[model samples]
Target chain A: MAPSRPYQPLLLRLLHGLNSIFVIGAIITGFWTYDTYDGRWGRLPLPQFKEIESIHGTFGLYALLLLPIFALYAFRRGQRRLIQPDTLAKLTQVGKPIWWYTLHRITNTVMLLALTFAVFSGKMMSEKWLPQGEFDHTWYYLHLIAWAVMILCISVHLLMSARVGGVSLLLSILDLKFRPQDSPALWSGHIRNWLSQRFKGTPK
Target chain B: MKQNLALTIIEIIVFISIIAAWIIPLLPKLEPEPNTGSLILSAPGAVWLIPVAAKQNS
Candidate 1:
């Protein structure tokens, strides 16, 4: 018999959903903006559309605003479980060549930071810089680079999550139709097993 | 632990560099332009100001 893990907090689940939607919207709208501004990146011609650019910029701003809230929640709720010495010790012995968890956290943080700057600079460029005929090539250059980096980082994050958490875990986040499994129960059972083994001083 | 520390330091450096790269351009600097164009824009030239290209001349 094993202890049952509690269900994920509703607020965290909602935030995750919102964050995922905004991120995907931002990426799509970003491509639209790129085509509108500089269409050379894509193979097919994507004409610039003012409406699309506006949508992209708006979504980007929204994501930027939501990030700190999510970060705070993650820190407050998971601080002990995520960063405990015991957890780290377990992780170090997992025998996985790649530190998937560490990389996932680092990449997500980097992407968020990059996205924040992208949105901030974009707003500044649109409101102050662009209107004044201050077409700073540097801003455009950095924005493009940031967009590329963010995309790359996100791709890597998705791949790693799928690899480590399995397809079902990844799909569960997407609200897709999948066979029901008592994931919380399973996770709690795992924790109980680990704790017992560790306490009993048995090799895992 | 050492590896994690090293990675954190590297990430911080990269983050700072990115911020600096963006902020540097925002600072005001003297940009000299040729004085050959008319200092004052006429009414039609004023229309040009509405578009991004028109402001480039100034």
Candidate 2:
């Protein structure tokens, strides 16, 4: 028999899919905004559009809104995907599969941190600054740096996932067929149980 | 131990590079700009809730 295809939880797929859409949108629009405004680094040959900043800000706002929810899910349900205490030790295994997996986890964690910095720095910026020829804002510079780091982190994330689990793992996140237990109908109850568990030992 | 040391060194370099990227630009003294309205309603699907005018001003 052929090997069974991997499955992902519906909620992970939904959140990841939406977050990816918004983040990627922000990334592309962010570049356009850069090209249009502060091309001190270099300018693309593409046409410049001043309104791209507003569009980029819109995508960034959406990404910012989705970030907390995605981060909560990542920390709570998908904790294994992030770096663990033993990750450093695992990285020492150099050529081993475990090493690649450890690197993948590190990349995942870095991606989360990079996105947080990008959005938080972006939130600190005023839309008027770019249009008004004011680009020296510390927050704006930090946001640009965050954008660069996010790109690098995302690249490493894809490379590490491909190295560790191959194409199957990459496809799993987009998989639509989920087990009954992972159904959306049970989400409320699951959340309630998780909340209760968290508060179980707390003072009344 | 050699491999571990090598990996540790690389990690340290990467961490320092990121920190440098963040800090180097801010080292120069720059004047802080005063406040302006933020892009709170800039995102798609967001509504702008215009505050009601004061009764006396109206």
Candidate 3:
């Protein structure tokens, strides 16, 4: 038999991959929209228009719609990757992969928070708000701040992934390899058990 | 091999982003505010926006 390959759950991979696409789309379009309207801070020669703002807002809305599902999976099924008090202790360890793991978790958490801010503040803004030369809006400023946080966190997240798991791990996620045992047929059963366990107060 | 592939992916994303940021700005802006307000749609004072109106005034 071939050496047992590392097993990342199929559902986890699907959710993570989908969310990554959405987050990246949100970032680029979000920045493009910012550069379009708010060129006062620094103007990129990029063409500005109201229509591009609509595209950015639509992507932001899609992310908002998908976020709760990703959060549920992260907190319930993949809780170990989330930062807890124990995670902080791991971060204190020197010369250990655990510290890198902790950094990954921190970036994951920050990315989610940044997206939340992006969605909410972005919803509060109108396409015309910035075009009318209105720069004093509180929500617009908050959205800009959220975009900045996302850029920083995402850049670090990219570096940290290579620093830790390396290309094999990253490519593993991108790979479409699936086994008969990891089929979607098992998902409903798993979800039912998880929900029942939650109601019955059983430990996850 | 996977590690190198993963790093290459990141490097590609960063590279594309830099290229895009520079390239996108080169697209034209909205057609310079329609220098001549459409003749049929003009409001009474809209003609004042025409350069000829300014020259005649001067």
Please name the candidate that would achieve the greatest TM-score relative to the true structure: 2
Error of 3 at B52 (Å): 49
DockQ of each: 0.06, 0.05, 0.02
Best by lDDT: 2
The best candidate in terms of DockQ: 1
Chain A of candidate 3 scores what in TM-score?
Answer: 0.89
Chain A of candidate 1 gets a TM-score of 0.65
State residue B39's C-alpha deviation in candidate 2, in Å.
Answer: 24
Lowest lDDT sum, 10 consecutive residues, model 2 chain A, at A195-204
Error of 2 at B52 (Å): 28
- Local accuracy of candidate 3 as per-residue lDDT tens digits, B2-56: 1334323433443343344334434332322354442232332332233455446
Ranking by TM-score: 2, 3, 1
Model 3, runs deviating above 4 Å: A1-6, A201-204, B1-58
Write candidate 2's Cα lDDT for A90-132 as tens digits. Answer: 8899998888888898888778778877887787677989989
DockQ of candidate 3? 0.02
Q: Give i-RMS (Å) per prediction.
A: 6.4, 8.4, 11.8
